[model samples]
Target chain A: MKVTDEILNRFIDGELNSEELKEFKDELNNSRDVQTQLRALQAASVSFKNIKEDSPAVDFTSKLMLSLHKKFKSRRRDSIFIASVASIFVVISLLIIVYILAQIISAAGPNSSFQPGLQVADIFEKIAQTFVSKFSSSSVSIVGTIISFGVIVSGYFYFDFLKSTRSN
Target chain B: MIKLTDSEIIESIKRGNQSDYSILVDRYKNKAYSLLKRMLKNNMEAEEVLQDSFLKAFQALSNFKGEAKFSTWFYRIVYNTALTRLSTKKRKIEMEMSSIDDYEFLKSGFDIHSNEKEDTAKMVNELINRLPEKNAAVVSMFYLDEMSCEEISNVMNLNVTNIKVLLYRSRNILRDMIVQNNLVEELR
Candidate 1:
């Protein structure tokens, strides 16, 4: 039976069965070619084994750590900024709701005591009138455009922050 | 200080000891860099990819279930990062090479043209670097990392049988080169 390089590879890898091992050993005892092949394979294996690991740049770890630190700091700032913005939005929303409710209550009951110098309802009417009378369609459209741009920029930063946090 | 296990260091990093990650980095950087150097065949690109790999691993550390060894998981990042860089450079790495044609091509194509006598180790190293990217990665993972074929299969996303085939074919090619160049005596 011919002992091929495949068989020798299996032998080196300890993939040979007991029967195959016995047969291979028998062949090994008789054949110089098999011995030569085995030696060559072993030498090749040794050469690989002798390979030294290549180091990265000397500052690799420090540079990575510095970047990580920067990411952490930036994420912290983003978190704080998002939290502040959200808090302001919630507070403003609640104040507006309370102002509207107070206006409704005052309008419904003449005896209601909550009264600001400028009534919220009148302010809303005046603002609506101003938009309708003084603001041109193009001006209103410009305002809408500005609002849309603001929303888009905020959304972009929010998603970008989320991505940064998740990746970090 | 006692050397912390990779798992222990990872735990510390998870606990907010971000600096502790440097321990794992120091432990793996050289070996993983070696793997990248072989796969990318350019030291600068390899180093850049290695840094990116470490960043990716750190980012994904929370998802590490520790089901596999850390080295296996980390090397997968290293391998994939180098692969992406290679793709970006439009360098196609052959994943599957026909055994007979690959063996014959490697055997005939390996020519060490330098007339100056070279060390066997350096000669063998150059031969290894000349291997196809994926094949070189397998050899590096197997010998440099001392990883088993199973672990290599995990990192390379190939079946264990395929990994063995790559390993065997690579070794045979290296064996032929060694024998042809009369380097076995030096190894002996």
Candidate 2:
């Protein structure tokens, strides 16, 4: 079998199997061409080893770290912004739900039946009754649903912000 | 001083010890710079792209799964960033280079006759620099970085067979040049 340059290349790279290795050795012992080719390849390989790696400027690390620091700061600012927006959204949603409840209670004339100040339990019952009564109104249901969805979405964003901050 | 593995360092960075990243940066900077320098053939551009590659790796670190070695992943970033820079400079070639005829490929930039007085290493470096971009990267990564063919395949996004072929062909060219110049003895 004729030994090709590819064979020699694989041989030098130690990619040959045990059978191929034996055949290559036999060929190497017999052929001057194979020997010369192997010699040249080995020389080239050694020359490649002489090529040194290039170094960057002295400040490369410092500059990269500075950029990373900026990136972290920006990321923190974004997390803070998300948290603030989500907090504001949750607060607004709660206020709207409270306002809707108060409007329903006032419309029900609960103050006339309860006298001046009502117990917490009575107030909750009146709010629940009025809420159930108005539950059939599509506008009321939608407003309630929109507020709940907004709050849930805001909670999700807030959770995501916490996760991101912790990971960073 | 017990040295931490790349994964350890990455975990530390992910855990908010971002400063530990400098260790990785220092570790890979030179070898990666060598790769970029050979790929771009411009020291200034190589350094600039090296920085960009590092920043990109840092930004994308959270997405790195440990399926491959860190060197493999990092070099992939470097190789791709260099390719992008090359394309922006309007010098990017097809990554699938096996179809190009060897003669046409050799005729493009196989000039070894220039500067005959340089030493073997310098001559070898010059010859590698004169090769096609992908070919030069294969030689550099294979030898200078001491990366295996599989690792180079991962970085270059080529199949292992193609990488082996490129490596063999490139080393053969260097061998032929060394033989012709009678630099084989000096190299040994």
**Number of the top-ranking candidate, with lDDT as the measure:** 1
- Chain A (alone) TM-scores for all candidate structures: 0.67, 0.59
What is the per-residue lDDT of model 1 for residues B1-188, given as tens digits with 9 covering 90 to 100?
78778899999999999999999989999999999998888899988898889889999999998999999999999998888888887775343333333555555544554532355566667767777787899999999888999999999999999898888878888888888877787775
- List, residue by residue over A44-113, the lDDT tens digit for candidate 2: 8878878888899999999999978877786878877979879999999999678756755775583565
- In candidate 2, stretches whose alpha carbon ends up further than 4 angstroms from where it belongs are A89-93, A111-168, B94-118
Scanning candidate 1 chain A in windows of ten residues, the lowest lDDT window is: A112-121
Task: Give per-model TM-scores.
Answer: 0.83, 0.75
lDDT (Cα, tens digit) per residue for candidate 1, span A40-90: 998888878888788989999999899888887887888899899899999
- iRMSD, per candidate, in listed order: 0.9, 1.0
| Residue B158 in model 2: lDDT | 95
Model 2 residue pairs with clashes = none
DockQ of 2: 0.62
TM-score of 2: 0.75
